[model samples]
Target chain A: MSETTEKTYKRSHEPVFWGLFGAGGMLTAFLTPVMILITGILIPLGIINSQNFSYEKIHGFATTWYGAVIVLVLVALPLWHTLHRIFHALHDIGINRGRDWQQVICYGFAFAASIFVFTLLLQMF
Target chain B: MTKRKPYKRELPTDWWLKHAFYTKYMIREGSSVLITLYSLILAWGVLRLSQGEAAFNGWLEALQSPFSIFIHLLALALALYHTITWFSLAPKAVDLWLKGKRLEDKVIVAGHYGAFAVVTVFCLLIITL
Candidate 1:
């Protein structure tokens, strides 16, 4: 084969984002509802003892390595899934202008938020 | 380069609103917005947690607000909707086969629900107990 006949494939970044999206989707599907219920309703309403969510308790948990990882995943991963969907949903709603900018903002927001949480977790540790 | 203008069909902004199926699909997609908001709230909580006990407690206290409760209620409902939709679509993505036979869709979906239940309960137990 001649050198000019060689084909170069441009690798797409879709799989990385898609992998995060799928993992986030799975986490959200399995855990988000109860999380909302506990933090949002049950504990806040005092149906579940507010003491159970006391600051010391949560802070203690967050200081541990495993706890930090869990907290980071719980807080940040869903943004990957949701923001990906939001990006596509914008197109579905016919906001076709600035597709490049839209993709940047969508993925950028998820990236920024993930970093924000990750930084905080590191500091806590 | 030869100039080329490909004809493109115009899609109306309200295209999804015209049909019940499309509306539900859009709603499913829209769940992302609220879930994103929820995640941000948790992120804020983490930030507060790092600040100290007063800050973290304040964050938790804020959750008790009527408006916060309402938003969480809405988010919970939407998140549950997302879960249902995600589970239903799982079989298409999973493609599991056993003993030279493809697994049934309902079986895959049911397995998701079972796992969801276990996870939810496990979280609750961990937090409360």
Candidate 2:
């Protein structure tokens, strides 16, 4: 078989997505396990009392500004990060057709979820 | 005239599992699933909070199940693995310059760990309060 011809292409506008991916990655690396420890292990295992995250306390926390910010960051960034990875994984797994549709769906879901969560948090305030 | 046949080797889809290097890379990439799960869980909690105290309490009680605990343990393991790999790579993505010289990789890596520790403590403080 003959070798395929080489061609030049313009750079992709993926830096924006990469920026979100990096931020989401950093946040997940630092924060996710800690959150699991508190909610999953400590509370369920009785290491820390269950009431620590009781409805009253948690609701109060949600109404606070800093709490809202934390929740927003914690929820939104990881969504972007995960969808971004899934998008690339699809290409790696060789379903490379319909690139435009794939990009729109994957990133679009992250965008919609972020907006939805932000709106909910604002409504709580 | 003579005709020649083309030789080709198809890559298996599970090729990543065949080598330790590829396996590690795939696992690191896949850790995003765990991160996404935790994010959704948190978002759900926030949603419950917005609904009112009863809904939030129900959500908290749901979290107390043995199944939930198991999932959390699994998530914690994946999250830790993600953290280790991500931190080791942090210096590559971040640049710090001082006195017209680039900082050492060791310094950057160490700084990430230090900041991680501080953040962990801050989280604990906030949670316990």
Pull out the clashing pairs in model 1: none
Candidate 2, residue B84: CA error in Å? 0.4
RMSD after CA superposition, every candidate = 4.2, 3.2
Q: Could you say which candidate leads in DockQ?
A: 1
Could you give the interface RMSD of each candidate, to one decimal?
A: 0.7, 1.4
lDDT of 2 by residue, B32-93 (tens): 77767777787787788889988977887888898888888888998899889988988887
lDDT of 1 by residue, A16-119 (tens): 98999999999999999999999999998999998998988888989899999989999999999999999989888888999899999999999999999999
**What clash pairs does model 2 have?**
none
- Give the alpha carbon lDDT tens digit for every residue of A6-123 in model 2: 7678998999999898888888888877888888788767777777777777767667999788778878988888889988987866787998999999999889889888988999
Worst lDDT run of 10 residues, candidate 1 chain A, spans A1-10
The segments of candidate 1 whose C-alpha lies over 4 angstroms from its true place after superposition are A1-11, B1-10
- Candidate 2 overall lDDT versus native: 0.83
Candidate 2 docking category? medium
